[model samples]
Target: DHFVVLFPILSRNRFSHILKGLAMSGRQITVMLSYPSDEVGNHLMDLDAMYKANLNPHTDVLSRQEFRKLFGYTFKHPFTGLDYIDLYMDLAVDNNIEVVLANDPLAALSYSKDVLVATIHDRKHLKNLLLNNGGNTIIGLDELATKQGKSGGYNPEFGLLGSNLAGNNRLKLFPRDAEQFCYAVQKKLFEKTGKTVEVLVYGDGAFKDPVGKIWELADPVVAPGFTAGLMGTPNEIKMKYIADNELVGLSQEEAQRQLKQKISQKGTNLLGQNASLGTTPRQLTDLLGTLCDLMSGSGDKGTPIIHIQGYFDNYASE
Candidate 1:
Protein backbone atom coordinates (compact mmCIF):
# COMPACT_ATOMS: atom_id res chain seq x y z
CA ASP A 1 0.00 0.00 0.00
CA HIS A 2 2.80 2.41 0.87
CA PHE A 3 5.52 1.36 -1.59
CA VAL A 4 4.66 1.73 -5.27
CA VAL A 5 7.26 -0.58 -6.83
CA LEU A 6 8.29 -0.06 -10.47
CA PHE A 7 9.69 -3.28 -11.93
CA PRO A 8 10.89 -3.49 -15.52
CA ILE A 9 10.93 -7.20 -16.26
CA LEU A 10 13.30 -8.90 -18.75
CA SER A 11 12.56 -12.62 -18.67
CA ARG A 12 11.13 -15.44 -16.51
CA ASN A 13 14.34 -16.22 -14.61
CA ARG A 14 14.96 -12.52 -13.88
CA PHE A 15 12.18 -12.19 -11.22
CA SER A 16 10.33 -15.49 -10.98
CA HIS A 17 11.72 -16.70 -7.62
CA ILE A 18 10.88 -13.43 -5.85
CA LEU A 19 7.36 -12.96 -7.15
CA LYS A 20 5.73 -14.67 -4.14
CA GLY A 21 7.98 -12.86 -1.67
CA LEU A 22 7.09 -9.54 -3.30
CA ALA A 23 3.44 -10.51 -3.07
CA MET A 24 3.78 -10.66 0.72
CA SER A 25 4.95 -7.02 0.70
CA GLY A 26 1.44 -6.04 -0.45
CA ARG A 27 2.91 -2.99 -2.19
CA GLN A 28 1.25 -1.36 -5.18
CA ILE A 29 3.69 -2.72 -7.75
CA THR A 30 3.90 -1.20 -11.23
CA VAL A 31 5.68 -3.34 -13.81
CA MET A 32 7.06 -1.57 -16.90
CA LEU A 33 8.12 -3.53 -19.99
CA SER A 34 9.83 -2.56 -23.25
CA TYR A 35 7.84 -3.80 -26.19
CA PRO A 36 9.09 -5.58 -29.40
CA SER A 37 12.25 -6.33 -27.44
CA ASP A 38 13.66 -5.98 -23.93
CA GLU A 39 16.88 -4.09 -23.14
CA VAL A 40 19.03 -7.11 -24.15
CA GLY A 41 17.23 -7.52 -27.53
CA ASN A 42 14.89 -10.37 -26.59
CA HIS A 43 12.11 -9.66 -29.08
CA LEU A 44 8.63 -9.85 -27.48
CA MET A 45 6.84 -9.60 -30.85
CA ASP A 46 7.85 -9.55 -34.50
CA LEU A 47 8.78 -6.11 -35.94
CA ASP A 48 6.56 -6.63 -38.96
CA ALA A 49 3.60 -7.48 -36.72
CA MET A 50 4.03 -4.30 -34.68
CA TYR A 51 4.44 -2.16 -37.85
CA LYS A 52 1.36 -3.77 -39.43
CA ALA A 53 -0.65 -2.91 -36.29
CA ASN A 54 0.48 0.75 -36.51
CA LEU A 55 2.62 0.95 -33.38
CA ASN A 56 5.64 3.10 -32.67
CA PRO A 57 7.91 1.92 -29.84
CA HIS A 58 9.31 5.45 -29.40
CA THR A 59 6.03 7.21 -28.55
CA ASP A 60 3.33 4.62 -27.85
CA VAL A 61 2.55 3.07 -24.46
CA LEU A 62 0.33 0.01 -24.11
CA SER A 63 -1.83 -1.11 -21.21
CA ARG A 64 -2.38 -4.80 -20.35
CA GLN A 65 -5.69 -4.88 -22.24
CA GLU A 66 -4.22 -3.25 -25.34
CA PHE A 67 -1.14 -5.51 -25.30
CA ARG A 68 -3.22 -8.70 -25.06
CA LYS A 69 -5.74 -7.54 -27.68
CA LEU A 70 -3.15 -6.52 -30.25
CA PHE A 71 -0.76 -9.45 -29.82
CA GLY A 72 -3.42 -12.07 -29.13
CA TYR A 73 -3.08 -14.92 -26.59
CA THR A 74 0.30 -16.58 -26.01
CA PHE A 75 2.60 -14.46 -28.16
CA LYS A 76 5.56 -16.82 -27.85
CA HIS A 77 9.23 -15.93 -28.18
CA PRO A 78 10.89 -16.89 -31.46
CA PHE A 79 13.58 -19.02 -29.84
CA THR A 80 12.48 -19.89 -26.31
CA GLY A 81 8.84 -20.12 -27.41
CA LEU A 82 7.82 -18.63 -24.05
CA ASP A 83 5.32 -15.79 -23.99
CA TYR A 84 7.44 -13.55 -21.72
CA ILE A 85 4.67 -10.98 -21.27
CA ASP A 86 2.08 -13.58 -20.34
CA LEU A 87 4.62 -15.43 -18.19
CA TYR A 88 5.50 -12.29 -16.21
CA MET A 89 1.88 -11.15 -15.78
CA ASP A 90 0.68 -14.61 -14.80
CA LEU A 91 3.34 -14.81 -12.08
CA ALA A 92 1.85 -11.71 -10.43
CA VAL A 93 0.95 -13.54 -7.19
CA ASP A 94 -0.56 -10.38 -5.77
CA ASN A 95 -3.55 -8.37 -6.95
CA ASN A 96 -1.49 -5.22 -6.22
CA ILE A 97 0.57 -5.75 -9.41
CA GLU A 98 -0.03 -3.47 -12.43
CA VAL A 99 1.67 -3.74 -15.86
CA VAL A 100 2.53 -1.08 -18.43
CA LEU A 101 4.52 -1.24 -21.68
CA ALA A 102 6.95 1.58 -22.55
CA ASN A 103 10.55 2.42 -23.36
CA ASP A 104 10.67 5.70 -21.39
CA PRO A 105 12.07 5.47 -17.83
CA LEU A 106 10.01 8.47 -16.71
CA ALA A 107 6.71 6.72 -17.51
CA ALA A 108 6.72 5.05 -14.08
CA LEU A 109 6.00 8.42 -12.41
CA SER A 110 2.52 8.46 -13.93
CA TYR A 111 1.59 5.45 -11.76
CA SER A 112 3.52 6.22 -8.55
CA LYS A 113 6.30 8.37 -7.09
CA ASP A 114 7.68 5.68 -4.75
CA VAL A 115 9.18 3.00 -6.98
CA LEU A 116 11.65 0.16 -6.90
CA VAL A 117 13.64 0.16 -10.14
CA ALA A 118 14.30 -3.43 -11.30
CA THR A 119 16.55 -3.27 -14.31
CA ILE A 120 20.08 -4.60 -14.90
CA HIS A 121 22.27 -2.44 -17.19
CA ASP A 122 20.26 0.82 -16.99
CA ARG A 123 19.52 0.65 -13.22
CA LYS A 124 21.71 3.56 -12.14
CA HIS A 125 20.68 5.85 -15.01
CA LEU A 126 17.01 4.97 -14.57
CA LYS A 127 17.16 5.53 -10.82
CA ASN A 128 18.77 8.91 -11.35
CA LEU A 129 16.25 9.78 -14.05
CA LEU A 130 13.42 8.84 -11.69
CA LEU A 131 14.92 10.87 -8.83
CA ASN A 132 15.41 13.91 -11.06
CA ASN A 133 11.80 13.63 -12.26
CA GLY A 134 10.16 13.97 -8.80
CA GLY A 135 10.25 10.39 -7.64
CA ASN A 136 9.59 10.00 -3.92
CA THR A 137 11.40 6.69 -3.26
CA ILE A 138 13.80 5.26 -5.79
CA ILE A 139 15.88 2.11 -5.25
CA GLY A 140 17.80 -0.01 -7.79
CA LEU A 141 17.93 -3.82 -7.63
CA ASP A 142 21.73 -3.57 -7.30
CA GLU A 143 21.25 -1.74 -3.98
CA LEU A 144 19.40 -4.73 -2.50
CA ALA A 145 22.21 -6.82 -0.94
CA THR A 146 25.22 -4.55 -1.29
CA LYS A 147 26.70 -4.95 2.23
CA GLN A 148 25.03 -8.20 3.24
CA GLY A 149 26.97 -11.23 4.52
CA LYS A 150 28.59 -13.71 2.10
CA SER A 151 26.78 -16.81 3.44
CA GLY A 152 23.53 -15.37 2.15
CA GLY A 153 25.37 -14.48 -1.07
CA TYR A 154 26.16 -10.79 -1.64
CA ASN A 155 27.92 -8.60 -4.20
CA PRO A 156 29.24 -5.29 -2.92
CA GLU A 157 29.71 -3.86 -6.41
CA PHE A 158 26.92 -5.23 -8.61
CA GLY A 159 24.66 -6.33 -5.73
CA LEU A 160 21.87 -8.32 -7.46
CA LEU A 161 22.26 -6.90 -10.96
CA GLY A 162 24.20 -9.77 -12.57
CA SER A 163 23.10 -12.42 -10.13
CA ASN A 164 21.71 -15.89 -10.66
CA LEU A 165 19.30 -17.48 -8.19
CA ALA A 166 21.02 -20.41 -6.49
CA GLY A 167 17.96 -21.16 -4.44
CA ASN A 168 14.83 -19.42 -3.14
CA ASN A 169 17.11 -16.87 -1.43
CA ARG A 170 20.74 -17.38 -2.44
CA LEU A 171 21.93 -15.38 -5.47
CA LYS A 172 25.30 -15.99 -7.17
CA LEU A 173 26.59 -12.61 -8.30
CA PHE A 174 29.05 -11.61 -11.04
CA PRO A 175 32.71 -11.73 -10.08
CA ARG A 176 34.25 -8.68 -8.35
CA ASP A 177 37.69 -7.02 -8.67
CA ALA A 178 37.76 -7.86 -12.37
CA GLU A 179 40.75 -5.57 -13.07
CA GLN A 180 42.71 -7.07 -10.21
CA PHE A 181 41.78 -10.57 -11.37
CA CYS A 182 43.12 -9.84 -14.86
CA TYR A 183 46.44 -8.67 -13.42
CA ALA A 184 46.61 -11.73 -11.20
CA VAL A 185 45.98 -14.00 -14.17
CA GLN A 186 48.58 -12.13 -16.21
CA LYS A 187 51.10 -12.51 -13.38
CA LYS A 188 50.36 -16.25 -13.10
CA LEU A 189 50.74 -16.69 -16.87
CA PHE A 190 54.11 -14.87 -16.79
CA GLU A 191 55.23 -17.05 -13.88
CA LYS A 192 54.27 -20.32 -15.65
CA THR A 193 55.66 -19.31 -19.08
CA GLY A 194 58.50 -16.93 -19.97
CA LYS A 195 56.29 -15.06 -22.43
CA THR A 196 54.09 -12.21 -21.20
CA VAL A 197 50.52 -12.93 -22.32
CA GLU A 198 47.85 -10.28 -21.88
CA VAL A 199 44.64 -11.29 -20.11
CA LEU A 200 41.08 -9.91 -19.88
CA VAL A 201 37.91 -10.63 -17.90
CA TYR A 202 35.17 -10.88 -20.48
CA GLY A 203 31.47 -11.41 -19.89
CA ASP A 204 28.81 -11.72 -22.61
CA GLY A 205 29.87 -10.14 -25.90
CA ALA A 206 28.08 -7.34 -27.80
CA PHE A 207 26.73 -9.73 -30.45
CA LYS A 208 23.26 -9.68 -32.02
CA ASP A 209 21.44 -12.80 -33.25
CA PRO A 210 19.79 -12.35 -36.64
CA VAL A 211 17.43 -15.29 -36.08
CA GLY A 212 16.06 -14.54 -32.56
CA LYS A 213 16.66 -10.79 -32.76
CA ILE A 214 18.35 -11.10 -29.35
CA TRP A 215 21.68 -9.67 -28.32
CA GLU A 216 24.20 -11.76 -26.39
CA LEU A 217 25.07 -8.69 -24.33
CA ALA A 218 22.68 -9.34 -21.45
CA ASP A 219 25.46 -8.36 -19.03
CA PRO A 220 26.72 -4.84 -18.36
CA VAL A 221 29.71 -5.02 -20.74
CA VAL A 222 31.82 -7.35 -22.84
CA ALA A 223 35.16 -6.84 -21.10
CA PRO A 224 35.19 -5.27 -17.65
CA GLY A 225 38.97 -5.44 -17.28
CA PHE A 226 42.08 -6.15 -19.34
CA THR A 227 45.86 -5.71 -19.25
CA ALA A 228 47.42 -2.44 -20.44
CA GLY A 229 48.30 -4.16 -23.73
CA LEU A 230 44.61 -4.84 -24.51
CA MET A 231 43.57 -1.19 -24.10
CA GLY A 232 42.31 1.09 -26.94
CA THR A 233 40.79 0.34 -30.38
CA PRO A 234 42.60 -1.48 -33.19
CA ASN A 235 44.88 0.81 -35.24
CA GLU A 236 45.32 -1.05 -38.54
CA ILE A 237 44.87 -0.23 -42.23
CA LYS A 238 42.41 -2.07 -44.51
CA MET A 239 44.53 -4.57 -46.49
CA LYS A 240 41.72 -5.17 -49.01
CA TYR A 241 41.36 -1.42 -49.66
CA ILE A 242 45.14 -1.00 -49.95
CA ALA A 243 45.43 -3.98 -52.32
CA ASP A 244 42.52 -2.98 -54.57
CA ASN A 245 43.00 0.79 -54.78
CA GLU A 246 46.63 1.73 -54.05
CA LEU A 247 48.40 -1.44 -55.26
CA VAL A 248 46.21 -1.95 -58.35
CA GLY A 249 47.75 -2.92 -61.80
CA LEU A 250 50.99 -3.99 -60.09
CA SER A 251 52.26 -7.64 -60.36
CA GLN A 252 51.34 -10.01 -57.47
CA GLU A 253 54.91 -10.00 -56.09
CA GLU A 254 55.25 -6.23 -56.58
CA ALA A 255 51.85 -5.59 -54.90
CA GLN A 256 52.89 -7.75 -51.94
CA ARG A 257 56.18 -5.87 -51.56
CA GLN A 258 54.42 -2.49 -51.78
CA LEU A 259 51.82 -3.59 -49.22
CA LYS A 260 54.54 -4.67 -46.78
CA GLN A 261 56.39 -1.38 -47.32
CA LYS A 262 53.16 0.62 -46.72
CA ILE A 263 52.45 -1.41 -43.59
CA SER A 264 55.96 -0.69 -42.30
CA GLN A 265 55.68 3.04 -43.14
CA LYS A 266 52.04 3.55 -41.91
CA GLY A 267 51.29 6.16 -39.27
CA THR A 268 50.59 5.10 -35.63
CA ASN A 269 47.00 6.29 -35.57
CA LEU A 270 44.69 5.26 -38.44
CA LEU A 271 41.36 6.67 -37.35
CA GLY A 272 39.16 8.24 -40.12
CA GLN A 273 41.77 7.45 -42.81
CA ASN A 274 40.77 6.18 -46.26
CA ALA A 275 43.23 3.27 -45.93
CA SER A 276 41.41 2.09 -42.74
CA LEU A 277 37.87 2.40 -44.16
CA GLY A 278 37.11 -1.34 -44.41
CA THR A 279 38.56 -2.14 -40.95
CA THR A 280 36.21 -2.35 -37.95
CA PRO A 281 36.44 0.82 -35.83
CA ARG A 282 35.70 -0.69 -32.40
CA GLN A 283 37.42 -1.58 -29.16
CA LEU A 284 39.88 -4.47 -29.37
CA THR A 285 38.29 -6.07 -26.32
CA ASP A 286 34.81 -5.87 -27.91
CA LEU A 287 36.10 -7.65 -31.03
CA LEU A 288 38.01 -10.24 -29.01
CA GLY A 289 35.11 -10.73 -26.64
CA THR A 290 32.75 -11.36 -29.57
CA LEU A 291 35.18 -13.86 -31.09
CA CYS A 292 35.86 -15.58 -27.76
CA ASP A 293 32.18 -15.66 -26.85
CA LEU A 294 31.43 -17.32 -30.17
CA MET A 295 34.19 -19.90 -29.56
CA SER A 296 32.83 -20.69 -26.10
CA GLY A 297 29.10 -20.77 -26.66
CA SER A 298 26.85 -20.29 -23.61
CA GLY A 299 24.51 -22.86 -21.94
CA ASP A 300 25.05 -26.54 -22.85
CA LYS A 301 27.83 -26.11 -25.45
CA GLY A 302 29.77 -23.66 -23.27
CA THR A 303 33.42 -24.16 -22.34
CA PRO A 304 34.28 -22.13 -19.24
CA ILE A 305 37.51 -20.78 -20.72
CA ILE A 306 38.59 -20.01 -24.32
CA HIS A 307 42.20 -19.87 -25.51
CA ILE A 308 42.95 -17.28 -28.21
CA GLN A 309 46.32 -16.80 -29.96
CA GLY A 310 47.86 -14.39 -32.49
CA TYR A 311 44.91 -11.97 -32.27
CA PHE A 312 47.26 -8.98 -31.93
CA ASP A 313 49.18 -9.98 -35.10
CA ASN A 314 48.85 -7.67 -38.10
CA TYR A 315 50.53 -7.39 -41.51
CA ALA A 316 53.06 -5.08 -39.81
CA SER A 317 53.97 -7.73 -37.20
CA GLU A 318 56.94 -10.05 -37.95
Candidate 2:
Protein backbone atom coordinates (compact mmCIF):
# COMPACT_ATOMS: atom_id res chain seq x y z
CA ASP A 1 0.00 0.00 0.00
CA HIS A 2 1.11 3.55 -0.72
CA PHE A 3 0.11 6.44 1.54
CA VAL A 4 0.50 9.76 -0.17
CA VAL A 5 0.29 12.77 2.12
CA LEU A 6 -0.27 16.17 0.55
CA PHE A 7 0.79 19.32 2.36
CA PRO A 8 2.32 22.69 1.53
CA ILE A 9 4.99 22.22 4.17
CA LEU A 10 4.84 19.37 6.64
CA SER A 11 3.80 20.51 10.11
CA ARG A 12 3.85 19.09 13.67
CA ASN A 13 2.69 15.47 14.08
CA ARG A 14 0.20 15.73 11.24
CA PHE A 15 0.40 12.11 10.07
CA SER A 16 1.71 10.26 13.13
CA HIS A 17 -1.51 8.44 13.89
CA ILE A 18 -2.16 7.62 10.24
CA LEU A 19 1.13 5.69 10.01
CA LYS A 20 0.41 3.80 13.22
CA GLY A 21 -3.08 2.86 12.08
CA LEU A 22 -1.66 1.61 8.77
CA ALA A 23 0.80 -0.58 10.65
CA MET A 24 -1.90 -1.96 12.91
CA SER A 25 -3.93 -2.85 9.86
CA GLY A 26 -0.95 -5.01 8.75
CA ARG A 27 -0.34 -3.39 5.36
CA GLN A 28 3.09 -2.86 3.82
CA ILE A 29 2.87 0.88 3.17
CA THR A 30 5.23 3.32 1.52
CA VAL A 31 4.64 6.91 2.64
CA MET A 32 4.88 9.68 0.06
CA LEU A 33 4.93 13.36 0.93
CA SER A 34 3.69 15.64 -1.84
CA TYR A 35 5.53 18.94 -1.68
CA PRO A 36 7.97 21.17 -3.52
CA SER A 37 11.64 20.62 -4.44
CA ASP A 38 12.93 23.23 -1.97
CA GLU A 39 10.87 21.99 1.00
CA VAL A 40 11.55 18.22 0.74
CA GLY A 41 14.04 18.26 3.60
CA ASN A 42 11.82 20.53 5.70
CA HIS A 43 8.88 18.13 5.34
CA LEU A 44 11.10 15.09 5.95
CA MET A 45 12.18 16.71 9.20
CA ASP A 46 8.54 17.34 10.02
CA LEU A 47 7.84 13.67 9.38
CA ASP A 48 10.68 12.85 11.75
CA ALA A 49 9.13 15.22 14.28
CA MET A 50 5.75 13.53 13.85
CA TYR A 51 7.31 10.15 14.71
CA LYS A 52 9.14 11.55 17.72
CA ALA A 53 5.99 13.21 19.05
CA ASN A 54 3.86 10.05 18.82
CA LEU A 55 2.90 8.60 22.20
CA ASN A 56 3.71 5.00 21.13
CA PRO A 57 6.06 5.74 18.30
CA HIS A 58 7.61 3.00 16.17
CA THR A 59 11.05 3.59 14.69
CA ASP A 60 10.66 1.33 11.62
CA VAL A 61 7.56 3.30 10.50
CA LEU A 62 9.49 6.41 9.49
CA SER A 63 11.44 6.39 6.21
CA ARG A 64 12.44 8.75 3.38
CA GLN A 65 12.72 8.46 -0.41
CA GLU A 66 15.45 9.96 -2.59
CA PHE A 67 14.29 13.51 -3.08
CA ARG A 68 13.24 14.23 -6.65
CA LYS A 69 13.20 17.62 -8.38
CA LEU A 70 10.09 19.54 -9.40
CA PHE A 71 9.41 20.95 -12.88
CA GLY A 72 9.49 24.53 -11.64
CA TYR A 73 7.75 26.76 -9.16
CA THR A 74 4.49 28.00 -10.72
CA PHE A 75 2.89 28.74 -7.37
CA LYS A 76 4.99 31.09 -5.22
CA HIS A 77 3.24 30.39 -1.92
CA PRO A 78 4.47 30.33 1.66
CA PHE A 79 6.55 27.40 2.93
CA THR A 80 3.74 25.81 4.95
CA GLY A 81 0.77 23.49 4.37
CA LEU A 82 0.57 20.42 2.07
CA ASP A 83 3.29 19.49 -0.39
CA TYR A 84 1.60 18.16 -3.52
CA ILE A 85 4.80 18.04 -5.57
CA ASP A 86 6.37 15.69 -3.04
CA LEU A 87 3.38 13.40 -3.36
CA TYR A 88 3.96 13.07 -7.10
CA MET A 89 7.70 12.57 -6.83
CA ASP A 90 7.59 10.01 -4.02
CA LEU A 91 4.86 7.99 -5.75
CA ALA A 92 7.06 7.60 -8.82
CA VAL A 93 10.09 6.71 -6.72
CA ASP A 94 8.66 4.12 -4.26
CA ASN A 95 5.65 2.28 -5.71
CA ASN A 96 6.18 3.27 -9.34
CA ILE A 97 2.67 4.66 -9.56
CA GLU A 98 2.02 5.37 -13.23
CA VAL A 99 -0.49 8.17 -12.93
CA VAL A 100 -0.16 11.48 -11.14
CA LEU A 101 -3.49 13.17 -10.64
CA ALA A 102 -4.49 16.73 -9.81
CA ASN A 103 -7.95 18.20 -9.42
CA ASP A 104 -7.18 21.53 -7.78
CA PRO A 105 -9.72 24.16 -8.85
CA LEU A 106 -7.25 26.32 -10.69
CA ALA A 107 -5.85 23.25 -12.36
CA ALA A 108 -9.34 21.99 -13.11
CA LEU A 109 -10.69 25.37 -14.27
CA SER A 110 -9.44 24.91 -17.82
CA TYR A 111 -11.04 21.44 -17.98
CA SER A 112 -14.45 21.99 -16.42
CA LYS A 113 -17.54 23.93 -17.37
CA ASP A 114 -17.48 25.91 -14.20
CA VAL A 115 -18.91 29.41 -14.14
CA LEU A 116 -17.67 31.89 -11.57
CA VAL A 117 -20.43 34.39 -11.05
CA ALA A 118 -19.53 37.42 -8.96
CA THR A 119 -22.63 39.38 -8.00
CA ILE A 120 -23.12 42.92 -6.70
CA HIS A 121 -26.35 44.20 -5.21
CA ASP A 122 -27.31 47.83 -4.59
CA ARG A 123 -29.83 48.24 -1.78
CA LYS A 124 -32.55 45.59 -1.26
CA HIS A 125 -34.14 46.20 -4.66
CA LEU A 126 -31.36 44.38 -6.49
CA LYS A 127 -32.07 41.26 -4.48
CA ASN A 128 -35.73 41.39 -5.45
CA LEU A 129 -34.86 41.86 -9.09
CA LEU A 130 -32.39 38.96 -9.02
CA LEU A 131 -34.90 36.63 -7.39
CA ASN A 132 -37.54 37.43 -10.03
CA ASN A 133 -35.24 36.80 -12.98
CA GLY A 134 -33.74 33.51 -11.68
CA GLY A 135 -30.49 35.31 -10.97
CA ASN A 136 -28.96 35.24 -14.49
CA THR A 137 -29.23 38.55 -16.32
CA ILE A 138 -27.13 41.62 -15.60
CA ILE A 139 -28.87 45.00 -15.58
CA GLY A 140 -28.61 48.41 -14.02
CA LEU A 141 -31.45 49.89 -11.99
CA ASP A 142 -30.89 53.35 -13.53
CA GLU A 143 -31.45 51.89 -17.01
CA LEU A 144 -35.06 51.74 -18.00
CA ALA A 145 -36.33 48.38 -19.25
CA THR A 146 -39.50 50.00 -20.54
CA LYS A 147 -40.68 53.56 -21.09
CA GLN A 148 -43.44 54.96 -18.83
CA GLY A 149 -46.87 53.24 -18.82
CA LYS A 150 -47.74 54.95 -22.11
CA SER A 151 -47.01 51.76 -24.10
CA GLY A 152 -48.72 49.66 -21.42
CA GLY A 153 -46.69 46.53 -20.32
CA TYR A 154 -44.02 47.06 -23.00
CA ASN A 155 -43.12 50.47 -21.48
CA PRO A 156 -39.94 50.85 -19.42
CA GLU A 157 -41.96 52.50 -16.64
CA PHE A 158 -44.27 49.47 -16.54
CA GLY A 159 -41.25 47.15 -16.35
CA LEU A 160 -39.95 49.06 -13.34
CA LEU A 161 -43.42 49.14 -11.78
CA GLY A 162 -43.87 45.40 -12.34
CA SER A 163 -40.47 44.75 -10.78
CA ASN A 164 -41.48 46.79 -7.76
CA LEU A 165 -44.78 44.95 -7.51
CA ALA A 166 -43.03 41.54 -7.66
CA GLY A 167 -40.75 42.54 -4.82
CA ASN A 168 -43.65 43.46 -2.56
CA ASN A 169 -45.62 40.36 -3.59
CA ARG A 170 -43.15 37.50 -3.04
CA LEU A 171 -43.78 35.73 0.31
CA LYS A 172 -40.14 34.87 1.00
CA LEU A 173 -37.66 37.50 -0.10
CA PHE A 174 -34.40 35.61 -0.28
CA PRO A 175 -31.35 37.68 -1.20
CA ARG A 176 -30.50 37.23 -4.85
CA ASP A 177 -26.83 37.97 -4.32
CA ALA A 178 -25.31 34.48 -4.61
CA GLU A 179 -21.86 35.58 -3.47
CA GLN A 180 -23.18 37.04 -0.22
CA PHE A 181 -25.49 34.10 0.29
CA CYS A 182 -22.74 31.54 -0.31
CA TYR A 183 -20.35 33.43 1.95
CA ALA A 184 -22.92 33.60 4.75
CA VAL A 185 -23.61 29.88 4.49
CA GLN A 186 -19.90 28.98 4.38
CA LYS A 187 -19.15 31.26 7.35
CA LYS A 188 -21.83 29.59 9.47
CA LEU A 189 -20.72 26.11 8.41
CA PHE A 190 -17.05 26.81 9.10
CA GLU A 191 -17.93 28.17 12.53
CA LYS A 192 -19.96 25.07 13.26
CA THR A 193 -17.41 22.60 11.81
CA GLY A 194 -14.38 24.44 13.17
CA LYS A 195 -12.65 23.69 9.88
CA THR A 196 -10.54 26.14 7.95
CA VAL A 197 -12.29 27.05 4.71
CA GLU A 198 -10.66 28.97 1.89
CA VAL A 199 -11.97 30.14 -1.47
CA LEU A 200 -9.94 31.25 -4.52
CA VAL A 201 -11.53 33.58 -7.02
CA TYR A 202 -10.37 34.25 -10.63
CA GLY A 203 -11.72 37.01 -12.79
CA ASP A 204 -10.98 40.21 -14.75
CA GLY A 205 -12.65 43.47 -15.82
CA ALA A 206 -14.74 45.59 -13.43
CA PHE A 207 -14.33 42.69 -11.00
CA LYS A 208 -12.77 45.34 -8.74
CA ASP A 209 -16.27 46.57 -7.91
CA PRO A 210 -18.40 45.14 -5.09
CA VAL A 211 -18.15 41.46 -6.06
CA GLY A 212 -14.36 41.64 -6.25
CA LYS A 213 -14.18 42.73 -2.59
CA ILE A 214 -16.39 39.80 -1.69
CA TRP A 215 -13.93 37.62 -3.63
CA GLU A 216 -11.08 39.08 -1.54
CA LEU A 217 -12.63 37.62 1.63
CA ALA A 218 -12.13 34.32 -0.19
CA ASP A 219 -8.73 32.59 0.04
CA PRO A 220 -7.18 34.00 -3.16
CA VAL A 221 -7.90 35.39 -6.60
CA VAL A 222 -6.51 34.99 -10.13
CA ALA A 223 -7.63 37.84 -12.32
CA PRO A 224 -8.77 38.02 -15.89
CA GLY A 225 -7.68 35.29 -18.23
CA PHE A 226 -7.74 38.30 -20.57
CA THR A 227 -7.41 42.07 -20.32
CA ALA A 228 -7.16 45.07 -22.63
CA GLY A 229 -5.45 48.52 -22.45
CA LEU A 230 -4.64 48.28 -18.71
CA MET A 231 -3.37 44.69 -18.83
CA GLY A 232 -1.77 43.09 -21.89
CA THR A 233 -4.22 40.13 -21.98
CA PRO A 234 -7.85 40.08 -23.13
CA ASN A 235 -9.81 38.29 -20.35
CA GLU A 236 -11.74 35.07 -19.74
CA ILE A 237 -14.41 36.45 -22.04
CA LYS A 238 -12.08 35.97 -24.99
CA MET A 239 -9.98 32.89 -24.26
CA LYS A 240 -12.45 30.86 -22.21
CA TYR A 241 -14.67 30.49 -25.26
CA ILE A 242 -11.83 29.25 -27.46
CA ALA A 243 -10.48 27.04 -24.66
CA ASP A 244 -13.83 25.33 -24.20
CA ASN A 245 -13.96 26.70 -20.62
CA GLU A 246 -11.71 23.96 -19.25
CA LEU A 247 -8.14 24.34 -17.93
CA VAL A 248 -7.10 20.73 -18.52
CA GLY A 249 -6.44 21.67 -22.10
CA LEU A 250 -4.06 24.34 -20.92
CA SER A 251 -1.99 21.84 -18.93
CA GLN A 252 -1.02 20.17 -22.15
CA GLU A 253 2.45 21.19 -23.31
CA GLU A 254 1.37 22.84 -26.55
CA ALA A 255 -1.60 24.64 -24.99
CA GLN A 256 0.47 25.72 -21.97
CA ARG A 257 3.14 27.18 -24.22
CA GLN A 258 0.58 29.33 -26.03
CA LEU A 259 -1.24 30.35 -22.82
CA LYS A 260 1.97 31.21 -21.01
CA GLN A 261 3.08 33.39 -23.89
CA LYS A 262 -0.21 35.28 -23.76
CA ILE A 263 -0.08 35.63 -19.97
CA SER A 264 3.50 36.89 -20.01
CA GLN A 265 2.67 39.30 -22.79
CA LYS A 266 -0.55 40.82 -21.50
CA GLY A 267 -1.84 39.44 -18.16
CA THR A 268 -0.91 40.92 -14.80
CA ASN A 269 -1.39 38.64 -11.82
CA LEU A 270 -4.38 40.71 -10.67
CA LEU A 271 -5.12 39.01 -7.33
CA GLY A 272 -1.45 39.19 -6.21
CA GLN A 273 -0.86 37.74 -2.73
CA ASN A 274 -4.53 36.84 -2.57
CA ALA A 275 -4.09 33.91 -4.99
CA SER A 276 -2.30 31.51 -2.66
CA LEU A 277 -4.80 28.98 -1.32
CA GLY A 278 -5.74 25.29 -1.51
CA THR A 279 -8.54 23.42 -3.27
CA THR A 280 -12.24 23.72 -2.47
CA PRO A 281 -14.49 20.78 -1.46
CA ARG A 282 -16.18 20.74 -4.82
CA GLN A 283 -12.81 20.50 -6.51
CA LEU A 284 -11.57 17.82 -4.10
CA THR A 285 -14.70 15.76 -4.62
CA ASP A 286 -14.23 16.01 -8.36
CA LEU A 287 -10.69 14.70 -8.04
CA LEU A 288 -11.76 11.89 -5.73
CA GLY A 289 -14.49 10.89 -8.13
CA THR A 290 -11.97 10.65 -10.94
CA LEU A 291 -9.66 8.57 -8.75
CA CYS A 292 -12.44 6.21 -7.78
CA ASP A 293 -13.40 5.76 -11.37
CA LEU A 294 -9.85 5.03 -12.40
CA MET A 295 -9.12 2.66 -9.54
CA SER A 296 -12.50 1.00 -9.25
CA GLY A 297 -11.11 -2.39 -10.23
CA SER A 298 -9.01 -2.64 -7.06
CA GLY A 299 -10.73 -5.80 -5.81
CA ASP A 300 -8.09 -6.93 -3.33
CA LYS A 301 -4.50 -7.91 -4.18
CA GLY A 302 -3.55 -5.93 -7.31
CA THR A 303 -4.54 -2.71 -5.59
CA PRO A 304 -3.19 -2.11 -2.09
CA ILE A 305 -5.84 -1.48 0.55
CA ILE A 306 -5.19 -0.23 4.08
CA HIS A 307 -7.34 1.19 6.86
CA ILE A 308 -5.83 4.13 8.74
CA GLN A 309 -6.87 6.32 11.67
CA GLY A 310 -5.89 9.94 12.16
CA TYR A 311 -5.98 12.05 15.34
CA PHE A 312 -5.81 15.79 15.87
CA ASP A 313 -5.89 18.08 18.91
CA ASN A 314 -9.47 19.18 18.23
CA TYR A 315 -11.53 18.22 15.18
CA ALA A 316 -10.39 15.13 13.24
CA SER A 317 -8.56 16.81 10.38
CA GLU A 318 -8.14 14.67 7.24
Q: Give the local distance difference test score of model 1.
A: 0.75
> For model 2, what is the C-alpha lDDT against the true structure?
0.29
TM-scores for the candidates: 0.89, 0.17
Off by over 4 Å in 1: 2-9, 18-24, 167-169
Best by TM-score: 1
Q: Summarize candidate 1's per-residue lDDT along 94-185 as a digit string, tens digits.
A: 56666778877787788788777777777888889899999988987777777867456666776666655567655556667788998998
lDDT of 2 by residue, 1-318 (tens): 332221222322222322233345443333323321112233232334334444122212222332222222332223444444444334343333322222121221222222111112221353344435444332332232344355333322212211211222221111123344445655775899985443211221112224212111110112211112112321212344324543454567767565555444533443322221221222322232233323432235443322212311111111
* lDDT score of residue 291 within candidate 1: 86
